[model samples]
Target: MIELSREKLLLLYRQMLSIRLFEDRVYQLFLLGMVPSTLHQYQGQEAVAVGVCAVLNRDDFITSTHRPHGHAIAKGVPMKRIAAELFGKVTGCCRAKGGSMHIGDYSVGMLPAIAIVGSGIPIANGVALAFKLRKTKQVVVSFFGDGATNNGSFHEALNMGAIYNLPVIYVCENNFYGASTHISKVMKLENIADRASAYGIPGVVVDGMDVLEVYRVASEAVNRAREGEGPTLIECKTYRYSGHSRSDPANYRPKEEVEFWKSRDPIFQFKKKLLELDVLSEKEDNRIRSEVEKEIEEAINFAIESPLPSPEIALEDVYA
Candidate 1:
């Protein structure tokens, strides 16, 4: 595990808490009919996004999958802007167009998240290609789920990235279920990282629940990429605390399995680690939580107060 300084550890904790709180709030809002779009909450997979982005510079790019709120937050997108975007307000990053699935800000080097599974894989490769052609040292990280691994685009992108030695990191947040289907029913491989060998690149698996372990592995992979090495496939073994999407109770998942993963909640685990290491005290932690809660409330208020997008510009931002 990488030894993190107190400041860095606290930042990671804050980011994880922000994501957790943001998702919880969004879920509550959706239940109250405040948000009209579908939501794929990133409750259990916070460590993967936080750990990976922690090693990245501001200029580094990341392409996100449908479950992208955590990626945007971890990549430094402002909470108010993200909240506004989800509310479909004029002040939103995408002017309320991208909704819950496609939240991101290019100003922070994060692309508008791709909702389709496996689509961002090749898009990340393309971004890396642009960086390489410009002779820039920036790298790209592509976030996707295990279901994406089975797509043709995933293989195609990996092959191209390997051949050209693109500076990109492909992260598969293997939460064990693709939508409602278990991974076992789709692929026979015990671990998704094993597929990286087919593309002739290094494949690594880490404890997705452990932020330090994720940071350690990602730091090495990121350094390698910045040095002009090829991409790396990192399979983070994680589990989602919620169901596949809104209104689904995740009844397919066994009760024992759900409880098991909940016991390993990344936020809970990291808080315990910090306390044990003397890096944080209960009083300080409580203060942090209070501050974060207040921040989230401000974001919600901002989103609520913001005006809805005008119909005149509805078709204005389209690329085509």
Candidate 2:
């Protein structure tokens, strides 16, 4: 449905593979007490971020939610810096300040990812407002989860972004469950994207498992914003493979539901589609997985050996 080059698709595979390994490692390390902070793993939600980010220019920006590793890699943040940030090292992208939840670099066009739910939406407006006021063609994409839709900041931001006709893309990765609550129980509307119509804006429901499907839909939204067409609200139908956080035992979800989602794993599904299209071979996919594993291992070693930020910096990065 979209014109994705073989090289770019390969790159997407690399990005997803990279994210999977990193998050998997983080999960393991968390269990081992290697990480000081908890994590909201972005395992199953990779396709949405990568697919959406592929349509964005480097000059454009993105705001990330608690689950930001996928978005960071998709946007070209190097593994070394990301791992270093996770280690709270001076070499980190944030200079060891914004650890896990705050790993972002404005220089890279990513506002330090806001961990608070729906908190980044209004900030996204300010970023887009700056672009619009300066008459720049840049667009800003704000990535959040379904829970964010229920936050008051969500409504306030949508209204503000719409009123000013800001160049923004409000992307909600509706993975069925919000922190543990099912969307059907929390949201009255059948489709979250459908709510965009209320603000007189385009709302799109996308297949988040298919990278190309997400890319095609997001491309239109991104292009529309860049062309001064204002913001769009996109709801991606996806599922998380793990619990809300590291301590979660995942007892809230059913075994069948988890198995069903696993059966449709984004990586396997996309690999199948790529192979069917003669875009990728199983051999290449396996090799890519090997490479990704190696990269993550090296990143972990780098983080382990890197020195932690000075204790004094704890107070420095808090406000300044």
Candidate 3:
């Protein structure tokens, strides 16, 4: 509706569908104890990552959190590699070293996803700093949670980003809770993006459930950063239907709250919007979903059959 091309819209919808299906598959696999590590599923916030990545160039970057399957796929990391990494295979993106929390493919410009909350902020700032020093138009997109906004790293990163006019987009995916603690109880600010004023930068709030809305807002921020207009704080108001971790009982929240957000599922909403726009027929939608399902199954098979990392290799990257 905002002059977006049909091709771009279909691509956006595909990315959103990929994330939704991938995350759902990951959740099911994790519940069966097939995965060795903990998972912070990005089930509900697919729109934020997909939308932000849509407007990015191949040379641009993104930082991810523990809930990073969506970010990885959006950034163009192959599912086979992500699945292999989760299985600790040598063919993984990180050679099975990074696992679920740290899956990233830097060759395409996705820096190693920082799993520690708010830790990627400074690293992304440094990447932007390098680009700015070189006078290139590259921009780094940093993704963090609401709890991260309360971290010292978040404050420090924003301060430095402001002072240096770094080419970076700070995307705060506020999925309400910071590992079970609601944003309402933690910060006094009504909108996390409003905190951008403390550093004298533009701040914005967008509906994270709506992919196009996120893309529109993020396009502005990415362009501004590339043009040396400095960084902007974009707080994506989203909700994660899953628990904080696959292990958590999610006792901190109410069932009604979970259901409320679930009803507004990003994947369903995106498909509906696409249908309304006449961009896809019901048969075409089902086919797309079926394709994703087949790919996921193949990835699972590949991961299961892949060779595990050598025991000697465990000591290989530890020091060097």
The C-alpha lDDT values of all candidates are 0.94, 0.88, 0.90
Cα misplacement distance, residue 60 of candidate 3 (Å): 0.7
Q: Report RMSD (Å) for each prediction in the order shown.
A: 0.9, 1.3, 1.1
Model 2 per-residue lDDT tens digits across residues 25-132:
978887888877778788988889889998888889999988888888888777888888887788888888888888787766787899999999999999999999
Predicted candidate 1 versus true structure: per-residue lDDT over 87-164, tens digit per residue: 899899988888878888999999999999999999999999998889799999999999999999999999999999
Return the clash pairs for model 1, or none: none
Best by lDDT: 1
TM-score of each: 0.98, 0.96, 0.97
Worst 10 residues of 3 by lDDT: 311-320
lDDT of 1: 0.94
Off by over 4 Å in 2: 318-320
Shift of residue 173 alpha carbon in model 2, Å:
0.4
Q: How many backbone clashes does candidate 1 have?
A: 0
User: Cα deviation in Å at residue 249, candidate 2?
Assistant: 1.4
**Candidate 3's residue-wise lDDT over 33-68, tens digit each?**
877878888888999999999889989988888888
Candidate 1 matches the true fold with a TM-score of: 0.98
